[model samples]
Target: MNSFLSNAKRSCGEFLSSFKISQSTILHMVLGNNSCDLDSCVSAIVLAWFRSQMKNGNEVYVPVVNIERKQFRTRTEIAYLLDHLNIDSRNIICIDEANVRELSNVGKGFFHLTLVDHHVLLKSIEYLQTYVKEIIDHRPQLIELPSRIKCNISLVGSCSTLVAEEMLKNKAFSVPSVVETLLLATILIDTSNLSVDVGKSTPRDEAVVKQLSGKRTKDELNLLFRSVADAKFSVSGLTTEEIILKDPKWIENSLETIMMSTLHLDVREFFAREDSIDVIRNYCATHNLLAWVALAPVINQFKPIALYCEDDEVREKIIEKLIVSDLLLVKTSDEDHARSDVKFLRMYNCKNTRKQVLPLINEVLQQRSSNLSA
Candidate 1:
């Protein structure tokens, strides 16, 4: 067994043991966001490990948000990362593996939930807000969490950067080599290795990488980023629906639900596949989504493209919102990039991410809902 993972599992066992005894069970559940992106997963695992090292004698379990064991393969990058680090998923607890409703029934007060990666509580598990003990995130502070909860919300590119700070402050850097590699790789992938033009990373992210990056230069780390990007973009055998699930983001409110997928493949190459539209429509229908958005970077040029499908009025409204995003991107057309239900808008300067788009999407939904209510 890998030394770090074995030690991680030992903590899991101790955490699980507390659940067996209902009388004085104190379960410290560290959860990543529902998106379960690479940053979320790594932050949850690493932070839980650090907590265990604190020797609180209480149980600490890190649950991989919504990714079930069966759906694990859809997250190719995460799979690549864990496999590369010699971490076994069998030893970890996933949301599907544990009965969440049962866990909730155990009394929210009994569980101490520490959130990593996401600031807002997902609607699906909003009930757990009462149990939240701390929040460590990179996104803006959108919600008013409990005053007692330890909130470390910031605007860094990666939440893993914050977790790295905790590890360093706690003097828990004695973790195994594989763990170190995973932490460093996560920061790189999330921040594009601290690229200034991308403007996603902060000085803190760069400092954390420098502290953790031993014997590796910035150029060498760029090489690591390329390898990680290759792993992230490798979606050859996956079905179009599976591709949609790969890095999807969901924006929902009281009145609407929008499902958006961000693809690393070139927009042209993705639609060149015959069944892309058909599968996208199928996913939208299955989920009863009001709008479906796809964002991809053009091949080689790295230009951005945003694609969408839904009712014509709603579609046009979304396009208008994006146009005003001030991304300084032009809108070009490609019939091949469109189908009966899908429309593609090419972008010149591609700095926009789903993080920016989510708010725009929610605004449109809010307006539509308000109009109807009026």
Candidate 2:
């Protein structure tokens, strides 16, 4: 176990335990995005540690995982990496119902926030937007933050890359190898082992891996990537519902709501599972979603963009727009010709991700609504 992570674990526990609403010192909270993936959690944990070690950095920093602590197990890769470092996930500060209320009640000017891995403030934490002191993310700036807040937004494969740069810039640049390995592993997994074919890796991401990987050979790095990715994509014990909820991204428009989740297993195998269809329908109903989009990654193309919706007209319109648009959708060979209830399409434009698809889907939905009004 690296000494820094050990210290971080202890420090996070101590701070949370000692935190009080009446405490004189403001709680400097470092938080990641709601998804709480490996990159998000690592960035939060490491960036908080880095800031706390600076001169005049006596104000304690607490790394807060933005999800409920119970959901920590659902973040398999995060759990695996922390456990490997001998850092118990239980020791981490996670957002719970009680914690949310407690922090929300931390009177104005009594709390400070640093956002990582995400820029836009969601409704859950919008109350703390004015209290935000720093913004660090690798995505396009989506929200207008206060002028006084220090912004470090840039385009990179992983937000971890930006956090790694911060760690490197510190004068007292003594970071533990376990911490380095954690950052490197996150960048590798997010960038697909920094493969040129995947095209997600930027120069900064590559540099982080090259520098932090140390004497570990190419094979060692590859093994590390597989270990983390295996944990990330592993669904051995998870039920179908758990798999769908693992990394869900919600898309809501005035006309409808759609739930999109990454399918770690093969799409065909997923569809064949018992009660899978019922689960999708129930999930949609429970969340008031009009549809569900299940995406599975392929080596060269995004194969099998699956859609589950009972509304034939709505699903077909979205499909038609995608087929003619930049996504370059084509029907799958394994498409069930008899199954009119589901639609499976392939996308030739492998570079575009959900970030790009979400807007396009929204546009399609908007147009359909306009045409109906017309």
Q: What TM-score would each prediction reach against the true structure? A: 0.90, 0.86
lDDT of 1 by residue, 339-362 (tens): 656776666665667777778778
User: lDDT score, residue 107, model 1?
Assistant: 72
**Candidate 1 Cα deviation (angstroms), residue 259:** 1.3
Error of 1 at 311 (Å): 2.2
* Candidate 2 lDDT score at position 369: 65
Worst 10 residues of 2 by lDDT: 330-339
Residues 38-140 of candidate 2 have per-residue lDDT tens digits of 8888998888877777637346677887887666778888888888777766667776632545655666465678899887665556777777899999876
Candidate with best TM-score: 1
The TM-score between candidate 1 and the true structure equals 0.90
Once fitted onto the true fold, the runs of candidate 2 whose alpha carbons sit more than 4 angstroms away are 1-22, 55-58, 253-257, 299-302, 310-317, 327-334, 337-339, 362-374
Error of 2 at 174 (Å): 1.2
Please list the C-alpha lDDT of all candidates, in the order they appear. Answer: 0.74, 0.76
